[model samples]
Target: MAALALFGGIGLSEQKAKETLKNEALSGLLAQAIQQAQDICGSTLDKATGTLLYNAATRLKDQRRLGFLVNYIANKGVSSDLQLNASLDYIKNHPVDPIDTEDFERECGIGVVVTPEQIEEVVEATISKYRNQIMLDRYRFNMGLLMGEARNELKWADGKIIKNEVDLQVLNLLGPKTEADLEKKAKAPKQKAATETTEDKKESEVNGELHIAFERLVGAGSARGGESTNNVPPATATATAPPLMIPSVSLQPTQVSVPNFPADESKGFHTVPITSTIYIEQSDFREVTEKGYKRLTLEQSVGLRHAGYVISVQRVLRNKNGKLVELEATCRKSDMAEKPKAFIHWVSNPLMCELRLYERLFLHKSPEDPSEVPGGFLSDINPNSLVVLGDAMLDVSVRTAKPFDKFQFERVGYFSLDPDSTEQKLVFNRTVMLREDPGKI
Candidate 1:
């Protein structure tokens, strides 16, 4: 009875195992079969079911079952089909061979049976496709070999693989003209040297003309009897003097022909009549030394300020229009008795004096109060107002002058002292708006 029980147990376990296999196989087959049906009907299989079947096939390594399902789909032809029939056919025909048998081998010492002629055709097509693709997606393609891999895996014939030197020679023979065309394109064009421009030619001509004029003037002045004399002869006698036999000196102005520059109307080419009015008046003179005394009228004082100088009005005249005009006015430094001291005083009390004068005339607060005046009148002066007049007049003290120097001209305005100022002359630039409010102009 024990032996009988053992046999029955074994039978039950075997039945269970068989049932499990049957269930698994059926489940897999059903999934694949549905997908096949969908392909045949030219419609998509339910996504979840299709994924289950694909995953099962991969996990089980059941290539035969997968192949069978693919065959069923290829049998049907329709527009909405997945169009995977060719790929399926490839897998069915080229079954994976057993490693031990060595069923797969290279045809001509290479990995595939592709012929040289076929490779050449594929290479040409691939090169053309890649060139076009490069133009279309240059940035993406330049990123790396990933783009190339994608293109190659698409089964688009990439190009001939010249694994050996002999294959390269053969390819060269196939397209000899290509190399020649490349060489022709690589050659650079020859450039001609530039010729002299019109402006340069005109400058040369002007220099030549000036040289000739200078030589002629020198020769005429150096001729005999042209020496200076204190006594002046009568004009008639000088004109009638017997033809002086001055030595004949060969003086010929050299001719220099140069190209003329073309006229350009864009360069300040305009003509307009400019009319100027002048008035002259003779009047009496007067002088006053009293402090706080008005030296000139408001209009005259404004004119003096505009002139950027201290001028003494010696006379006043007016036209029929009731305008007080000044004439024969003499101007000298305000403190001419001590020129150096005056300069120092001007530098030290620049803005204060100007502001005082402005306030007295315009009935307005001192302009310096807002900008220069510190916390109070007793406060320190604005450091920016301190001018180094010593360095400023250095240029004018010497015969040679350097480049212009910009300085805060004390209280007046920012000035760019002109380098053209020599020992005999001095010039200063009044860069800021003379009036406090420019809009008033």
Candidate 2:
């Protein structure tokens, strides 16, 4: 009867029942479309989400701009709403590079960096609570019991970070690595240098960051460039940053390009000596502050991005007339222990240069359209289209960058070497902003 109504047979159904039933062949077309959709996106909603999640994870695997997606996937649980909102947010905040790890993570509720100490405590407690079982099971035991239990308590923390702590705790209890365990580890295939993988890649699931003082409880650390003179007006505030140590002894070149990474960086990258004086932009530090400002003001800490070291400001260095010029700082290696509020990009022995930032030439998107711009297109011309920074500084990583060479300055925008440059001076033009914003420089 319902089918008859759709066939225009509610009143004529008595005579047209046979005719209405004949449309089954047409309905098969609808069925075919559904079958095609199911083939592309799994048959059930659960299967569809699983496929989506897998694709999202795999596609975003090498993408640092996206936060540790494995962590997001593992923790997203069963809430489609949660998954959708988080995914949308990450897309919205996506950058030319990684989401600004400093602010983006905090804003998206990735929460503070779970310090090595905090992780150790949680792992120890979880293990101690189940000590008898761990002793009984040994290698045969479901180690994830420790992992899952600890993860429940620290939901916002990265799994790999937590896994490292768990490994250390379990080993301390289990004592020396048996020849069998060592051989098992040795037999495992090595991954590429660019990718960081664990002895057991299945940390039940999460992957996740930096600094020079390293408290490596276990596992290898990644140290970029042996010696970089790191000056912080920072971005991601690091807490016990991912364990790393720039050898007090420098073996690699002092100034290395970040793009040239993927060499033997275990002892940490090659080093350039820390200059006693490192220049900083005026805005990185603050002399005064208002309420709720979690920055390098009133005792807030910040990290030096990529360098993996934390800078503690002993005194703010200012030039004559009280302008912030530099920082008298002590850099220490991080153990991934404490959460710094922010991290920033800094350069040491940087090259003084000039930068030209560009905005849209017109204030309105459809400047030529009379409806869009009542005034002539000339009247729609934006006055702030060009912003020139004469005091811009660049580090040696890009020293090899010749004219027309393009680079993305993290948290800022994309830039290209300008035609007008001399051996003594360099100038760059902003090719694009990291994102579309009206008044950004």
Q: What is the C-alpha lDDT of each candidate?
A: 0.25, 0.43
Best by TM-score: 2
RMSD of 1: 45.4
Error of 2 at 413 (Å): 0.5
Q: For this target, which candidate reaches the highest lDDT against the unseen true structure?
A: 2
- The C-alpha TM-scores of every prediction are 0.14, 0.39
Judged by whole-model lDDT over C-alpha atoms, candidate 2 comes out at 0.43
Which residue pairs in candidate 1 have backbone atoms (N, alpha carbon, C) closer than 3 angstroms, thus clashing? 123-159, 351-411
Q: For residues 167-235, what per-residue lDDT tens digits would candidate 1 score against the true structure?
A: 222222221112222233334233222222111111111110000000000000000111111221100
TM-score of 2: 0.39
lDDT of 1: 0.25
